[model samples]
Target: MAARPEIAAVIWDFGGVFTSSPFEAFNRFEASRGLPKDLIRRINAANHHDNAWALFERNEIDTARFDALFLEESTALGHPVRGGEVLPLLSGELRPRMVVALKTCKQHFKVGCITNNVVSMHSPGQDEVQRAAGAMGQVMPLFDAIIESSKAGVRKPDPRIYLMMCELLAVEPGRCVYLDDLGINCKPAAALGMRAIKVVDVDQTLAELADATGLTFGAESVA
Candidate 1:
């Protein structure tokens, strides 16, 4: 049996974790819209490299300014492809692996989410957003806190957001376990003494968390 995790709480990232990152979906949308990947790249400018949204989520750039930049570049990519489409395309479907992890981890430890996300993308959704929100509400009950760049105005790698989540969960940094898809996001958490996990899939993370707490998580019922 796998050992239990030690952290009083486990924090997860939203975009790449609970929800699918519309990476492939964006490519599909682009190809269908006749917006070549290169053109999209040019529109986003250095977003891919510097992670502009992460900065925006961190409130390093005000929403209007960020939207303007994205709109200008995207319009340059395709006049018909408005900046409004950005949110829909970037929101990916939830991964089952992450769901399993969330569902399973919730029972053993306090769970929370810390993510670098855009407010424009996440804020409005009577339709798509609501759909995504519904899905999130399912597993998210597992979390003790939910921290997002859009809402918190601080993104990952910032360290403050990590601390905020720990604060909300009422757990010390050393007693928290943070998981994210990006190595950079994990760096600060690990430095702060949280047991950090970079999620490639989920098996390795589950095993590690299990080991930390000396508990057997996950039976044949779920992941």
Candidate 2:
């Protein structure tokens, strides 16, 4: 039997894992706009690796440019949508269970937060990025490191960002476990030897993390 790897760190994805997924809000936005479900996702996926979403997250495109380009893409897909209409929906409510789990993880291992995020340009004073930072601030002390795509110039599924997180945590890829709600984001981490958990819900993910790291992360303890 293969010996179990010594898990030294736990890396988490901010948008989906720690908070509710923006995709849930995306669906609501689509329904409110009377567009087909997953329209935003389709528009995003259509561009994939080089999409407006990717560029915006990398800080290569500013908010106005992203808004125009995103509108164009949505229009091309037969739905005229405004980026302003979508940006607000991207910030999901933080889950308390995740916060508890994070605190528990910090007791036993190093924790890091990696997120694909866009620069806050909604107004000269406030935007989603600021709001997100504020929301995460409560648990910020628990994390050993926090990486944002807009600051890092790289996003998930690219492999480099995962390595960047590992480097920041001062942990080897083989000695870490990563949890993300998106399978696409988890793929590269697993490829680099990090045990990856695809979070479907708080319970399943915590259970999987326990299995991976041999740490008891039961919801009851955190609750």
Note the Cα lDDT for every prediction shown.
Answer: 0.68, 0.83
**Pairs of colliding residues, candidate 2:** none
**Which regions of candidate 1 deviate over 4 angstroms?**
2-5, 33-66, 73-82, 120-126, 203-223
What lDDT score is found at residue 162 in candidate 1?
87
For all predicted structures, in order, the TM-scores are: 0.74, 0.91
The local distance difference test score of model 1 is: 0.68
- Residue 216 deviation, candidate 1, in Å? 4.2
lDDT of 2 at 100: 80
